[model samples]
Target: MTEPRICSDDYGILTSARDWLAAGREPALVTVLKTWGSSPRPPGSLLVMCRDAGHAGSVSGGCVEADLLERYRSGELGELPTRVDYGVNREEATRFGLPCGGRLELLVEALTDAAQLDELLAAMDAHRLLAREVDPASGRVRLRPAGPEPTFACGESGVTRVFGPAWRMLLIGAGHLSQYVSRLALMLDFDVIVCDPREEYARDWQVPGTRLVTLMPDDAVAAYTGHPRSIVLALTHDPKLDDLALLDALVSDAFYVGAIGSRRNCELRRRRLRDMGLPESQLQRLYAPVGLPIGSHTPPEIAVSILAEITALRNAAAPSAGARSITAA
Candidate 1:
């Protein structure tokens, strides 16, 4: 069992902003709308700030956080949706901790519409990716379903921002390996769920910041039928538990689907899925023998291997270690 994790990304910040607004603090939400030449954080990163000098999330990776806070204290940032830039010059870049020639552009919106924040959170809970568009002049806001992951954009009329759930994982096991994987998932800002039907194994599962479900893998897999931005990890190594979820994950739109096994077992699993009539394209999406082949034997090492591959996939980079490709039977 691990202690609860501290969530520092948009997931935590947005939720914190909702709570802060309810507590009578009208916080402004700052967004990194654009960056150029080696900025610390990527576009679309967020920071929620309050007048009393409290803040959540990050826009500069701690480089300009103190400076931003100092401005708030000095009344330099008035109550307005303002545009700001940092690292514009060499000395300023060094002072702000940006890369030598980095630049960051921000949109600081003083949010008064608690209802809009509520709507954004609701859409996320419903597993819907939303685009929140704001017109600078009129201050009109519109929220709608988003198409795909895109960087924040700005035009003459307005700013467009995308909001969605944090990364999530469904681990089909609750053993020691699952423990390690659960810890890694939480560290990566993923909402984790561990499912195992065996009462004996489930009884002692005590990882914090994760949901423990005493349900069969098939039923657990059914719960996330069409989930996007999720990873289905079959670490139980039991055919009964891993197979059902792996099958469902392959057909689902989850960004990643994987199972833990040896190369031979992965081949067997591939044949089994092919017999189940899965399309070749879909079958190719499954990373059986899941994780980079890092020669890992311990639970922690294996967990690292798994996260490395997931990180690669998330970043659109080639897998770091040796990769496994399952051919159609």
Candidate 2:
């Protein structure tokens, strides 16, 4: 409510809030309580703001951001837990940059302490999923282990928000495609790890915020086996690398295992994996020709397609690459 500042990194918001609070600045945390129609961000999205106008994370993609910033700067938002709705009318929609008839509601809280944020960040650092509940009405706060990403609630005890382990992406190759994929994945909050045993490819590999490993793709896959949020993608297009990683990953608890290939090659790979005694069920789980069929032809475009499919799978919005639909799961 003080001064609205917003960025797009979900994981960085808590850290930013911690820093702002430590700096003796007024930090306000805003969450997308609900939405209607074509909203840029979905429910549970966060926008952490400070009195100095510094922001981390986003509630809306853009238009609404400017309005929030202006409102906050004008001190129109009083110092209290408040609810705000945007785009209720046609003019408001246009002014706030919402799509036709789009609407969203937000809950704003001026946080006083960083203790809970410290705990949440610690849990995430330890690779533990935790739900931090805040009772703005009573100032009672608590943190507890979280289950599979749940649809959080906002009620009498206030809001229960999930602060989970970073999503993991294992890229099997260090080529151009993997380079683009890794960069984009990091922006999406994926803890990216690239495995390419070829020394030639490894030498010049330099993508900040991503870890590179020189090992057989299968060996890399083994290390990530049973990871709940892991999405393994083989972009090398070499059978030795892609097939081996796919074999190991498909059998693991990894939610999404994918490989880049042509449509015809996808069928061939399926047959080969089938001959390797990989069952039909597990084979079905494989996302061959990995990515949504987006008519992608360049490395960056291909990277987007891949991430799009991964996002879909992460939300169970569609059946991985086996199907494609824009609707929510």
Candidate 3:
């Protein structure tokens, strides 16, 4: 099985799309439109590969890429983009190594237009939701804004599905804790950015797959705009740094924002943020003394706790305020 890595998968797709557009090569993007019965990935997962750009995302374990690549190589698919289904029956299931009677489907479309690729890339960059439609007969795909309604295409040759928001995280410091957080967040498929202006901390920082900057906490917070899919964590104990970031995270669309501090310290910090024009309702979003009550003291252990809390919040789709409080003491 391909040990799935987020950076590898996401970057592969983005780079391949760009290269295909630049080289004027019309390539097909195959995404797992839907799955059923113990599939590896859920709905809306993607596997984008072309004759030129390898493959990104996975459909069924690892059994589908080689076949998809062969289809792309031969003229069987033609030059037009088409949505195709695989593993829809028992015989096909055994071929794909899907246990029992598992099945999967794909929307394969030869990306002939730069405009469609550009739009999808732009939506990804902005962390917005996008719904793409592809006709199996004509091999044409359409891009549009996604609505609240959940829709899936079941036809043999059409692809209709949503590409929701990108995973994102905001690290409030560039110190050791921030480094650990950033590294782990990348593994969890987050678009991570670390903010700190202290020269001592920013000078010797190095973590791959994370954006590092020396922006002030308040200014960095201004950039978040509180989107619903974001998570913010303040690692620095420095009041100036943690406070402003916490303030911004409290008001933004960030689903989780936490600060590292003792219980008493968290109380004081909350009071300060509340005094700084942050409403009581907004302040409720702040997750001070972050992480579950695991009695973690070491940096890595603390990081594990923090990541666990974030995962729980995401999977539950619950607000931070309503989450059960952690009493590490």
Candidate 4:
């Protein structure tokens, strides 16, 4: 899988892009178009350092900043856009101290057209993935659909794809545990939705910014059409509700589908799902014993474990990927 792209706007790159766009002068956008060997960030990592606005995005692990800063100070990048390669050999790697001999290729594009920059920003704000191509020799910019094309922009500079939006979470229960989970989800920038059909539960739900709904759990999951970016957790522990919701969630695109239950109950639930025509692979996606094995015995403690696991999944830094890969029950 391709490493996800970072938004120029998200990492405070908007300020630099805006300043250059406002000045009616082209500014250099230095992006770590590709990387090999040990690197802090993946491909598409960016540094939109402009002539006037300074720097955005980290290309190297603080090793290249001094040189980049010097280049910025000397106006070496102002002439036009350029492609620069760093860490060619052992000596160069030692000079830069790239930590594990990492080599990075940077594509610098002179963004002269404010309209194009504005369009890129708007597309990102709207949660669209964009592939930006620049001419290595001429520094011309072109926006194309994000995918594998031998070459885009008609043999221009290499392509850098920018991915937008954080992941989303939907909680099927708005109970005590849901409160803590929702709070942490917001802090993690996940768009959260809480669903509960019980009037009392929905009425008593008081967490701010969480989308509260009284829809049936199964219908709510169906309506959501959970995607790879979505996570659904059935914390109600009520089979009548959670079972159906879990059934819907397992068949959807949700990357994580979990429920709060004991080992025995989880086994029963799995058997029922398997009997309902769910494939063994699909059934395996159910994280019945949700969260990590932190021996969490309380609602708030369980919430912390759940949030930690979710964060690991989101960052792709988890020791193991997949729903049942980590179980605390």
Candidate 5:
């Protein structure tokens, strides 16, 4: 098994906030409520700062965090939740390390309820999706089941940000391509699990920060919980292993299912799976000959193309702005 991964999610920050509050220390929780133009971090990014000068997570590269820390320490940010904006103009954007023309609006709240933080963390631990809503005027926080997708919204009424597990990627093979794919996925904040049952392949699979499962591909898929936030990539290029995983992933709710192969091989694999009883609708969900048409041939280039396509599809599927419904209270 590979070494444990550094969790690439906000849960670590939330956990730290809970611990600090439980120790009778008041900390400030800053959330990026909105962004315009070329912001460094997206809306829903988190930053938690303790009065003792410790901090976790980030809303910007570094400058914004420095300013936020100063304000937090100087008591400018009080117990009540308030909105703070940075990089409203080009000069400010440069000063704050945001891209030119970038703008960020933040919600800063003093955390006093360890119970609430614990409850939110509990939901996440149980694999339950949740949305946290904060009222600026009254400093009230509410938690409820989140929608099928993650989202963030803010207006005069308050701020609502969905919190859920980190996205996951399950690779069906531990080949050379799998190594590159796994490394790239980790950098993108995905929990990567690789399944390769062959003793020869599994023995030398030494990618830190990834989990290696020896179970058969189909059983690995079954145990992985193909939730909507999951990605399944069959990189084995072997019909015996890759096909077994595809049969399971195609029928599941995993947001992205892909297989790396030549166009001809992909079509052949498609027919093979279809003949094995996978419906046309589910088969249509498969991204065969996976990756964008970037003409990639090398392992590293192919890995980049694969992740690029996944990123494009994921963003394309995000809820429309109208669904989040920004409004002033």
Candidate 6:
């Protein structure tokens, strides 16, 4: 007997939808199109619901899925791609359990073939960023290569949603602090890679969902497929190791390059790198003190600060006052 399949995350949703289609079930793929005011899910959130009421992913927290399923079951929803609105007013918001002032539009399209799903899933499996362009009026869709990030846009031309591999984090150490950072980065959907040549430190490193590299730190950076979606962190606190990684990372396209150290040590390291002939422009890219100025001490707290700063920069948001605060002694 064939075992049942398992699915998780956004990619898994499409995988499950493809499976349902293969089993002769017409599954409707729902995408949150536009949201006004407050919303349970963002504009790009996806949900795939089978004719049997089985569903994967979520457009709303849980408020509207049932009603959506009922509409499809009762034939209120059509085969052609169409748009539906929910919570247009206060009464409707209350009925759908949506927050006050919450309103959203959804585009639902029924899948009759697994061809497109197969193609998109293949691209994702190959770690290639891909975007799906959907024409709601014509029930047509096409795929194209996308940038390093996922983005959703809708306009007079229809809808475009980008999906692909997760961002990556390369930690140039397998020490205690690196352990905490790796775990947190994994939780945040980063493909974490920890590199350490020292068996003494690497032997005890066993963080699940993270790749361990025994290559020299500099060599690891070179082999990591440096790209705009990658980040490199030096947490060994050893100039010999961290400096080598930083030297290569700062010159690469990694979105963030950071080294964990005190102010004095950071300045000294910067001076050393500058003296080694690293251009002033490249030298400025180093996040020497690493993380935010949150004044974190312990390994876990320090991990939080590091990830928080990365998250802020990744989202292109300004650091909040609290995040920029130096904890009082």
Q: List the residue pairs that clash in candidate 4.
A: 134-157
Better of 1 and 2 by TM-score: 1
Cα lDDT of all candidates, in order? 0.79, 0.78, 0.72, 0.70, 0.82, 0.82
Clash count, predicted structure 4: 1
Model 5 residue pairs with clashes: none
Stretches of model 3 off by over 4 angstroms after superposition:
1-11, 21-26, 51-54, 71-85, 89-91, 123-140, 145-166, 316-321, 325-329
**Candidate 1 lDDT, tens digit per residue, 144-253?**
88855653677786788877766678999899999999999888888888889999999999998888887788787777434567789998878878888878887877
Model 5 deviation from the true structure expressed as Cα RMSD, one decimal place: 6.0
Q: Write the per-residue lDDT of candidate 4 for residues 1-329, one digit (tens) a residue.
A: 12223323343565566775686544556667667787666655667665544676677877776677677668775566666767878677778867577887777666667777666666555544466666567656677655322211323434645444345677988899999999988887676889999998899999886778788998888765365556899999888888889888988877788888888888888888878888877777777678877899998899998988877766567754443433432
**Candidate 4: global Cα-lDDT?**
0.70
TM-score of each: 0.86, 0.78, 0.77, 0.71, 0.88, 0.88
Cα shift from native, residue 213, model 5 (Å): 1.0
lDDT of 3 by residue, 38-74 (tens): 6766555667666754666677688777787787877
Q: What TM-score does model 4 achieve against the real structure?
A: 0.71
Error of 3 at 239 (Å): 2.7
TM-score of 3: 0.77
Can you rank all candidates by TM-score, best first? 5, 6, 1, 2, 3, 4
- Best of the two (3, 4) by TM-score: 3
lDDT value for candidate 3?
Answer: 0.72
In the range 1-329, model 6's lDDT, one tens digit per residue, is 12112122667888999999999878999999999878988888999998799999899878799999999988898665889999999999888878867998999998876888898787666656788999999988888888755478888998999876557789988989988998898788788888999999888888877888899989988877466677999998899999999899888977788888888888888888988789877877788688876768999999999998889887668453223322210
